[model samples]
Target: MAGPSSFAARRKVKGVQLTIMVVGQSGTGRTTFVNTLCEQPLIQHQQPVAPEEAHLESGIRINPVQVELEEDGVRVSLTVVDTPGFGDQIDNEFTFNEIMGYLERQYDDILAEESRIKRNPRFRDNRVHALLYFITPTGHALRELDIELMRRLAPRVNVIPVIGKADSLTPSELHDFKRRVMEDIEYYSIPIYNFPYDAEEDDEDTIQENSELRALMPFAIVGSEEEVEVNGQPVRARRYPWGIVEVDNPQHSDFQRLRTALLQTHLHDVKEITHDFLYETFRSEKLSRSLVGDSMGAGYGAGQDASVNPEDLATQSVRIKEEQLKREEDKLRELELRTQRELAERRQELLAKEELLRSLEARLADAQHSNSSTPLPPSQPQSPIPQQGQPHPVLTPHGGAPTNGLQ
Candidate 1:
């Protein structure tokens, strides 16, 4: 038993999983950042397109790559999903739906699995825990595309906004850029993951840590696969004409802090939020829509068509749910009234039985009293005459008339 228990514990420890998706335009240094974060060439850089073929639209593609990593002595099965050719098209409106569809598809898989009578032994959960949206280093504010993508996707995933290639701007410019981006997000009411913590419910260290991380929203990122010798030690740094920028240095970039938070400090928190909140919310909306569709007959079944507007579907779903709830409440109230009526009828029957019992007892008491109060009659003498055509009366030896009957 001890051997098997220990083996199972080890197996569980070895299977810690985390999925992250990177989304941004092509030149935002997403590939470099991922490689730098993983300390390997996990993703191959795309080839440069020819000038003649540059006009072609490739659309959006979602590619998931899995790798094994060890962080803090725990084996992590990490899946990095890359969104290439996003926001690169002329319109880019359909790209949002593509990304959203992919995210919801994973949720749909889990929902289907949950509804199954028999569970699949080899089920794999590919739901993304965090999304790192790389912002191009513009030294200004968020673009319309950035705002739109984040705003649309924030409700479905944990969006951690980061500026790719932070070394392109001055320190002051980078600070102001971060401020403006956060302001735009606030103005738009985008629900990005902001390192949430509760002061009253959390410990002092947690509150402080989360507060600091929140202040550093839209982390500045610098990525390099090259290593350079600095101060008699080799470190990952990007060489430049004037000075070298170190990837791990706090003064240079927020890469190290972001890495630590993603892999070590808050990995479990990210996964928990994804499963407990985001996924559950989606699951509920989906099930509500399905239920509403089924209850409203074939018209709602046809409403599931993609040609129908999404806002209309949402409105119909809410209305149906409200009607269903109202019907259930009415049924419950009727049941309660019926139960009260039955209880009242039972009470009346019991009261009638009690009254009848009381009447019977009174009658019985009266009969007993009459019998006890009455006295016996005096003894009567029998005549010594016989009936006509009858035998004469016989006497006992003592000359007494027969006591059996009158003579």
Candidate 2:
């Protein structure tokens, strides 16, 4: 029923919509990386804070910025959700909850919309397709914070770990760091989004490309906004006293490969996985929880309705119970760990206090001993006061006074 011009206009207005959420601590080049990837300033650099206000907790802020971009002659609608001050606080548990809640809320929105009798024509799907977690370039294994965050959120989003400000480390250091990070991820069973391809089913080029990208897991990112002349051509690079680090140089960093994979090659795959797996899983769990709750409230016998299969309902109920127990166990484990850390810190503090007390006692005892050991100089006999007209005696260098003034 639509005319050709109308169809063309609708196609022009509706391009591929992709939402990416970036999470990292401040000073990890998150903003610069987003800007560099977009080839324009999408996120403004955080303003410098005053020293007095530096310790204030700003809490986590979720900001979504929409931008239209063209990649490989295809119009793309991109939404970047930036989580500022995610890991800035001393306790990041709340921050984790905030981020997790945001992701699940998107799913909840979709669920509510699906349940509606009539669909809203202008509703937008803002579910985040991918999450880029910028790991701090510590040149060491992944921190507990990193492991915990990715572990908890991987079930909900496509988490891609990347090392930010990676130019700070040497090539060897970077390689070692990446190896250690991947090892930690494996050890902790963190489900990060690794570029996946089937060796038998996928084409050779696809397999090779994916394998290469997977090997470069936790991509090394060196982003810069400034341009410098390289071979008589201006390139985006961070100038240093020793050399220049180019953003697009494959040898310098993995920015270009990551950009291509994220925007060009694996974009559809990421979205498909999000909808097919993550959202579906969430929806199943949500519905199961609701059904289980209703069944329990009404009595177990009431669950054997004609419309629903008893076996499926029982299976869902058992699965939901297991999930609840697993979540509780996780919470208990986290609490125990936190308590142990606090106890250890308190023990250290007590030991330090005892040491200080002993030191002070020793110093006090030494002072008392010194004062008692050496008696004050014996009182000197007062010399007779000379009369107003009498001459004063001149004391010799020795202990005896001069017998006469002339002497």
Candidate 3:
């Protein structure tokens, strides 16, 4: 049995590419995990987010990073995408609505772009290669919202369910977690993995932990029967060189494994795609040849002859560009006018505040001066009597010796 790092060294493959996505509720360490994989601190939010701040890119935004990993003559291309935690304790509804809206807009945008490409002669067929979904483990089973989201996205993409934060669970607890997760995902037929199962630890510890998981999750499966244990309640998990592993963070260990696996698996598994699929695949070199030589002969040449005219395409493109430029100009003019009006209003507000402050200060000063100038009435002097005291009385200004108590 090999450790996670050693498995990385042993795995041999070439030129594999994969796109991975990390998702969860707000503040579930998604960003931190991505930064670890990228080997750099990416982005983090300091406060609870509203819908407006969801797209702000400072905190609640999607971050994409790419890296290449080579081990034992095997090369893999990994693209890790970090998305904002959809629902937060403080702003659950707002975040959910915003994210849902964004995804809807995103799908629409993709479809629109695909339509544009299909309409053009130059690009007829292109699409994204693979899609990986990441989620942190929770005590409860997959939520209704999770299932809904997965159902919506599964057909359109190759959904890989990654059980992130496996380190948080103990051996037995982890077993239960993986068991429940697989059972829930059975209906969707989504491939699931208990990833990041403490990759930094020794092989013995990880294998032991994995075995416990296998025992509890008997019906759950991996890529192959040989790679996983379905019987004997194997309390010690067998090592798979290609299975996902835990690293210090998602971007480094599990992230690397995902990248390496995709680069290998996609190159091997993907063969032919339909015209509809091509519109999304982005027309990479590996897939370009697969588009031609169809039975119906509905290809680049046929589409070009039937629906496209080169001069018209060029004219339409130029017209679109001109319209885009005009829109940009209009937006800039509107922004400038708004800015000037805001500045004028701010200046007036500031002047009013200053005048109010000055008036208050003057009133305060006047009150203080009047208080200081006003004099208090003098008190009456007391007479010193020799009979009442031991000392003799002193004389006063107006016969005070006789009148002031000389008796």
Candidate 4:
């Protein structure tokens, strides 16, 4: 029952690290929620756009802000990753890729670093423990964009759907909207991080607590950075003409519950699931691909997932490097083999041509020798010799009637 403000006296503890990413379209109270949850202005409000530039597409920006908060007297170092201009663009497909790419890149970084021989002691794990996806308060059902994003990103991160600016809806409207959103999530089979509890293994209190929190799927949140006097007591609230909305008031908003869960009671759970389940799945897939000699594409941007243990990351890094080196070695060996074969083939061709020329030259030389040694064309015809009193007829140069040259 301890809220963020009441955590100072609850329990004292050592340091703990928690990182949460807030993703939602602008104007969904994302900035205000962080400030209200931290009891200070942790994030700067985005500057208002001029009418002239309102229609332009501004790309998504992932900004992580670190803040120190004492939850239940335990010093909690929190990192809030804010996705600004996420859904603000007319073509928001890019933003979706940006976010998903960011998640995958963190995993990929660990994938690469895990295979390194030497571990980088200064390496920091920025993998998101939880992704709080704020559902726009349309006072109706879930938007297609909402369903699509949750469906796609759930596989990569722990997506906890929440309704932002719940003050926009009436009690009845909000009830119906939450129901519809959950229904849509279920229908689409989006694997949101519902508070899961194993009834048999978990204690009774744990089972009850998890069940209760699970029912609050898509927690409604109202956030305000302004403080106002409530019954002579200072309280963080939003000043409205109708009434004031207190940020920490359970009757007013679930902001306090979410803040506590994120930084206090369920903090370790989220991180555990991130490292144990989500990252494991990604690791298995990448290893399988690398096993088959396929590149992991360019998903490993300059980011690291918190899910990877430092030692494991270092080991994996070395393995991956060795694999890459082996592949390169294989390529070089093949190239050398090809060059050698080509050189041998060229030499063979030259030898064959030379042999052919030598054969032709020998034939020519034989012909010349034969011609030089050949009997010259007879200058005069050989006179026929009489054989035993037979008159021999000689071929006459001017063909005198060949009467044996006696006529």
- Lowest lDDT 10-mer window, candidate 2? 298-307
Query: Which window of ten consecutive residues has the lowest lDDT sum in model 1?
Result: 301-310
20 in model 1: Cα distance from truth in Å?
Answer: 0.4
lDDT of 4 at 130: 94
Over all chains combined, what TM-score does candidate 4 have? 0.69
Q: Measure candidate 2: CA RMSD.
A: 29.0
**Model 1 regions lying over 4 Å from their true place:** 1-12, 301-407
Best model per TM-score: 1
Instruction: Report residue 16 deviation for candidate 3 (angstroms).
Output: 6.6
Q: lDDT of each model, Cα atoms only?
A: 0.90, 0.90, 0.50, 0.84
As a whole number from 0 to 100, the lDDT of residue 301 in candidate 1 is 64
In angstroms, the error of model 4 at 179 is 0.5
Off by over 4 Å in 3: 1-17, 42-60, 66-78, 89-131, 188-259, 263-407
Which lDDT tens digits does candidate 3 get at residues 271-290? 12212343233222112322
| Candidate 2: segments with Cα more than 4 A from true spot | 1-14, 298-314, 317-407
Q: Which ten residues in a row have the lowest lDDT in candidate 4?
A: 288-297
Per-residue lDDT of 1-407 in model 2, one digit per residue for the tens? 99997787666533698999999999999999999999899899999999999989999999999998888757888999999999999999999999999999999999899768578999899999999999999997888899999999999999999999999999999999999999999999988889878878999999998899999988999999889999999999999999999999999999999999888899999999999999988887677757866866755453445556667866886786688689779979999999999999999999999999999999999999999899778999998888898788778778785565665
Candidate 2 has a TM-score of 0.71
Clashing pairs in 4: 114-313, 114-315, 114-316, 114-317, 115-316, 115-317, 115-318, 116-317, 116-318, 127-306
